[model samples]
Target: MDRGAWLFWVLIASLCGASAFFAAGAEGQRRDVRAASVTLESGAVVSLAEVVDGDTLLVATEAGEKVPVRLLGVKAFDTKLEKDVTKTYGQAAVDKLRVELEGKPIRVLLHSTPKDKHGRTIATLFVEEHDVGLDLVKSGLALVYTVYPFPTMQIYLTAQELARADRRGLWSNPAAVLRADALSAEWRRQAP
Candidate 1:
């Protein structure tokens, strides 16, 4: 072959190689996106972006969306509440949730009416096979939020009663001295 023809063929080979390289890179990106979120039979498994509080989480989806999810049957003391005792319990609840969920992938089962008035997704979160909301209730860090009924409402209520009986968490220290009924009413009044 002539020198010019050989040079032309070399240029053609380089262009083909570059095209293949670019295509492979694109496919790798697609695979990464898919790996970010996985769909389970009952729900979607997502990465925890932030634990907003005890009952709410910010989760990342496959499309790189950060969605706020409120646990369907759980309510924790508002961390923003003015009362110091309530705020202490709220902070404890947040700390507990962070320990359980931060830097972990969790399963999210969204409710039928997924969005709340604040546009947050209402979901039941799971770490492996354990229900995160129910666990909180059992530990006395949260109450069974019954405003909107859910399938596990009864279980959550039972857990709350047991926690109260066992004098765990808020049910024990701050709440024991601070009048549980009065604090509960105050928390409910200030709930967002």
Candidate 2:
């Protein structure tokens, strides 16, 4: 080929390469923007690294990010941070959660609000193909927190009420700590 013809082909090839690079960069930016938006529909498989009480957890996603997840519409017994004291039913609630979800793959459904004040991702988690938040309420391990309105909030609240009436788990105690007062009294001093 003549020099002019070869030079023309090289210019076209360079333009094509530049276009491809810009296209790829734009796609990446779009994905990042979507992730920042409210209510993403994508699914993520995460391993449960730690249960922060019954309703929150530290999960390691397949993408290698460590995320804190707050269970939607439920409140569990508070785990004691200090060695000097323990909360009633706190350890039991954690034990139940660990048995049900620890080391297992969880599916998270993010809410429009996204993160809480503590920086934990506010989401509804599913485990073993069932709604984890509902299960905790049905089993009487947690109470319906109703601070936010969600699609499944009513269902969870109903189940929790039944568990309370049946006097299961935390409900069985004579002290009967409600979600608001669960952290107030010591375990041993509270009636059983």
Total clashing pairs for each candidate: 0, 0
Model 2 is weakest, by summed lDDT over 10 consecutive residues, at 183-192
User: Residue 148 lDDT in model 1?
Assistant: 61
- Candidate 2's TM-score reads 0.67
Segments in model 1 whose C-alpha atoms lie over 4 Å from true places: 1-42, 174-192
What's the lDDT for candidate 2? 0.72
lDDT of 2 at 155: 86
TM-score of each: 0.69, 0.67
Residue range 1-192, candidate 1, lDDT tens digits: 999999999999999999999999999667545533433223788778788887887778756677777888887887897766767777888998888887777888876776677667788888877898899889888887765667888888789889988988788875543655664566557655
For all predictions, the C-alpha RMSD in Å is 12.2, 14.2
